[model samples]
Target chain A: MTVAVDIKNRLGDFSLEARFESAGRLTALFGPSGSGKTSLVNLIGGLLRPDQGRIAAEGRVFVDTQAGVFVPKHKRRIGYVFQEPRLFPHLNVRSNLSYGRWFTPKGERHDDMGRVVELLGIGHLLDRRPSHLSGGEKQRVAIGRALLASPRLLLMDEPLAALDDARKAEIMPYIERLRDETKTPIVYVTHSIAEVARLASDVVVMAGGKVAAHGPTAEIMQRLDLLSEEEIGEGGSVVDMTVSAHDESFGMSVLHSAAGEVRVSGLGTPVGASVRVRIRARDVIIATERPRGLSALNILSGKIASISSGNGTLADVLIDCSGQIILARITRQSCHALALEPGKPVFAVVKTVSFDRANTMSGVKPG
Target chain B: MEWLDLSPEEWNAVRLSIKVATWAMVASLPPGLLIALLLARGKFWGKSIVNGIVHLPLILPPVVTGYLLLLTFGRRGPAGAFLAEHFGIVFSFRWTGAALACAIMGFPLMVRAIRLSIEAVDRRLEAAAGTLGANPIWVFLTITLPLTLPGVIAGMILSFAKAMGEFGATITFVSNIPGETQTLPSAIYTFTQVPGGDAGALRLTLVSIVISMAALIASEALSRRLGRRMDLE
Candidate 1:
């Protein structure tokens, strides 16, 4: 495991008992605001001392209350990217990026300043002060600073939460490159499902300061109870697909995945680039027989594997198509009218235009 | 020229006042910053008490504070006796005593200014530094101290200005002596009390006004330059 956290803490009246192990290079702490997502990452980063329990990474103990082994944040060798850029305003961009290098023992310092500056594309911003940089530039510099520290694990607590969608997009490719190319593991904290789908290899879902679910991204995304009503209320599955072709005349790109092929609007990386496409459970429609002449452009035939027993009029149906699981939600009346059950063959329909560009995360290879 | 009109004795007073104020301001800077950090970020059992004691000079009468300092730092007092015996340092009726009085009197303003600036420092930045492998000391030195430069400058200026005008505390503690401890304010007070001293008093008053304004302008310019360097304001 790259990171392991089995800690219990109490802040005011809220109690957080989070226990999970992540083997992926990028592990996401997924939850809504105030669900202890930031707190969990902070605990791992040694920013906050847990009242009880332990936090270990790759067998090295960071925080173990039982042994009274609580490493101070500076000595822990864990870099943190906060929600705000948190750059030292008095220092210029180059100095800010190298601020952490001042503390790292020369022997442990491995990341070259030039390499990091080039990676983040901040070489031109070296002399400029943090105040002079835009929000996205500041965040990239912050990440570069953390990388220069040569930390064992990087904890990013919603590093892009302070930026708009455009800025987030601007900085995401760097993080993806960091995840794919770097030796150090990263624990990213985010409340956005799109972020998790795009970057995370493993997911640890948090709710009410507890670990609601923990598994790989592909498995956790389709967990209806974890992301459905009463929880996030935004239930979806993230399909890892690669761009096979682009039809410029029609303004659409062809996506090939294990589940099926899909065509989405908007532009991103060129052909053969991997992307994460999020298909919301509610947006998927189900039919017992193959329907023809429908407005929807995509339809995948699969066998029903599971039907969620919902107290409401709606229920979620899981289908297995070519070793990939697809989720569809239909009303209980329609379920009974069609006599839907496990092992029954069905077709899942989704509109070509319903897919949003924001949901299409194009960076990093699928794990 | 006003500078040429001053008598040698008046010049000595002016020079001594500058010396005392400079010493007071410079000496109090480290402690003022420490106290400010303690008040701004420290969590302790007697935080409020420490805060109260730092601000005591501002609320208490200057004479009382002077008397208190005299009791502790006077030649025969316990602290004074220990210091004199160990380090041969004396504060009774010496120029040093005047600086001490000024520092004590100006401390509250100094601490207040630095504390406000320290409080304004985004603790998130400090935490960010800590995560970057900077120890808390490094965090304070590289992040907190540099960011709080404006406040430190303001505090030093306030202390220096307060020291230049300090009279009651210095008179009560060190007693006004022409060459030894007489500052600008004390010199003006002495000139006003003596007969045929109105001209001297007016000259010194105008001098004091000119010097204080210069100090304020210099301080503002220095702070603005530092602010520009930081690009924070």
Candidate 2:
């Protein structure tokens, strides 16, 4: 599925001007609160008409101000999951799930109720009231309801924002499963960086009601200079790896990446399972020569790809280890001492203890 | 015990009161719902003016409202003339005129109850329904209407009760005609004006109180049931 949106609208004191196109399964709009992420999703869902813009999903025109073509929201076949899980209070869970199906033409109904119920794990909630369900359960049911509509595009605006950390963790996997299993393209809006890192195949970074950057998640996250400028300090590169071996004696897991194998702290997953590990630039240390003695467990040799100036006194060093990219944040003094420049060989030193297992997630397919 | 028995005229008054109240409530329901939806959702020019017009009966004296209705719907008036010529319908000095007066007097209460509920409905839910492929009208019928059932029931009950007690408007518009326009309130008023009529008036008063109390209780019970159904979702 493909979605193209170019819209300009002005609300009181807030002006939204955004344009982005993506064919990714899950394209996340990541930004701070009140940055117009929700507004962008609303525009795509036809909940809000832009003062000037053209929106087309799967080659069907939804809104085109210049052409005076405006399709109402119901005809657009776009499903929206609001932050509050706005379920119809008068209907039971089953009825709410089926409410959307009534509008779908009989012959055009493609989404099976059994599949959606199983996908969201809401089978047990079919007869229960929405008020009786937990917050996580309500969101699951909301998603199921939207899916049953057989929408070509789904817009999820912070579906987990109101949940606690445990609830968010509980729902994230289901969302991930939806991303992998369903062919429907989704535009997910959120302010949480971890959520974007875990779910977004494509990332559109929004700041101050404008698109700061948009690209493949890995490439966008690796641009530390731009991310730091926008106050996204935790932004870093993601590497796809697989569990090559597990050393029970040392309590460590060996992960094989495009660059090379690196040893990290124990991961619960069995060998051969795919994992994505995030290595923050701030946690990386650069060495001029191979370290003779150090507690750091893993080090990879690579050539400096580029050096970009960062906020205040810091600088970002980009390293290319076979085609994989790693970022290191260093001071100008350290750069001068190492005489680092493009084509200069350096060793990227990463502490195994600094590799947070909690931050590490599995199920990323290798390229 | 003696006051419990009603004479023929008192019985006719009681029956006319029931018919007038029922007709009035049924006649005003559709328009009340429409006006309430507009007042709750429409963003149009002169919305406040429309709101004032809907509420005018609440603040205006019943006699003045009755007079306005009489002038507009009288046999010689434009609306009355057109109706008489096209449909052979008549309201002047008839039981229908009495029902019309009661409906006008009770309209404000009905609209207010419905409008409040409509305003309290979550707009986000409507938007969600839209994304789920239900059109706006369908959303209102399936979501908005069911959720606001308690308010609609309340409005209907209030209008029915108001219509049963209508006196000044009914009298001014249709006059007191035995077996025709005279309802329970007007009957009680006439009985009180004559000597040796206290017992008859007391009987009708008791009936009126019983009907009003029953309606209020029924509405309360119905609203509770609706609330539970809505909470299921």
| CA displacement after TM-score superposition, residue B47 of candidate 2 (Å) | 2.6
Which 10 residues in a row give candidate 2 chain A its minimum summed lDDT? A352-361
TM-score of 1: 0.92
Q: How high is each candidate's TM-score?
A: 0.92, 0.95
Tens digit of lDDT per residue, candidate 1, span B1-233? 65439999899999999999999999999999999988998899999999999989998889998898899999988999999999999998999999999999999999999999999998888888998988888888888999898999999999999999998889999998989999999999999999999999988888899889999999899998988888862
Q: CA lDDT, every prediction?
A: 0.87, 0.86
Report model 2's TM-score to 2 decimal places.
Answer: 0.95
lDDT of model number 1? 0.87
Candidate 2 local lDDT, residue A302? 91
Off by over 4 Å in 2: A228-232, A352-367
Assign candidate 1 its CAPRI class: medium
In Å, residue B144's CA in model 1 sits off its true spot by 1.2
Q: How accurate is candidate 2 locally (lDDT)?
A: 0.86
